[model samples]
Target chain A: MIIGKVSGAMHSTINHTFYDERKTLVVDKLNPDGSLTGDYLIAIDTVGAGAGETVLVIDEGNSARQIVKEDNAPIRSIIIGIIDEVYVKI
Target chain B: MIIGKVSGAMHSTINHTFYDERKTLVVDKLNPDGSLTGDYLIAIDTVGAGAGETVLVIDEGNSARQIVKEDNAPIRSIIIGIIDEVYVKI
Candidate 1:
């Protein structure tokens, strides 16, 4: 799982059939300390996550396929839930 | 697929049963220009990859389980092949 923040959205004119009705977002991965690492990954959103919202992303193929309801979809990374808060023990 | 370089290897006595005879290596993901991002992930190696060798990593659960011959292994990263070379078009 990746703790990331939704940075932006993406759109494709010619793409796979599974992504026809899904919203793909550009998510910036956060470090363990909750700081942005400046690296990003594209993830299919399940929960209604908007820009700047922290989310939980499952970067596993089976999990993504199960949520998208397609076993053969060539996809990994799905926003499973929205993260409300994170606390790091010092 | 993730283009990464093997940084080092890891050993854990108490781990999952599926990892008993497998070799897990620390891989540093590379950017499109082949520069290391400094972040690392542990992956089970299929090919005999050594430290400092560039490799291709499949970070999908289904693919990892397929290579390990287990349908339910809790794995997502696998070093599928040792990369020979990479070229980026300008």
Candidate 2:
């Protein structure tokens, strides 16, 4: 899992048959210093992460497949947890 | 996998024992219109992906373990493919 700040929510009407109830979000990755790095992604939101919230995103494809119970879900990233706090050595 | 645009790179000194030569990158998630969305990440680069290149990232834990031959690598994101183009309906 990596630390990220939710920038906004992505609204899409289209959905795959496997992931029908999931909502996608646009999130920006953060550096250790809490600065915006650059790697960004459209991740499936399951943990109710909203914009400006620090979240722990998991890109576990296999686990998502197992959770969704689909053999071949195209999911690569998902919001697993919302970070309450972070501690890193400078 | 979700489509994303590689906005920038992330450089980190700290690395686990399992991943030695891998370089970490900071990426920003993007909307389909190419606008900066909020989600971002620190991803392990394996496909020589650079800043400004739209890349495909895989968050496969079990498959990565099989590739790295380690039970626990603590890796969540890795660049699996680079996107040449994206086509989404309006």
Steric clashes per prediction: 0, 22
iRMSD values, candidates in order: 9.6, 8.3
Evaluate residue B18 in candidate 2 and report its C-alpha lDDT on the 0 to 100 scale: 56
Q: Which pairs clash in model 1?
A: none
DockQ of 2: 0.09
State the DockQ, from 0 to 1, for candidate 1: 0.06
- Per DockQ, the best of the predicted structures is 2
lDDT of 1 by residue, B1-90 (tens): 456889998999998898888888999997534688877789988778889987666677775776677788999887766655443321
Q: What is the DockQ of each candidate?
A: 0.06, 0.09
TM-score for candidate 1, please give it: 0.53
Instruction: Estimate, for each residue in B1-90, the C-alpha lDDT of model 2 and write its tens digit.
Output: 445567776555665655567677877765555766677777776667778977655556554444444567787666555655443321
| Window of ten residues with lowest summed lDDT in model 2 chain B | B81-90
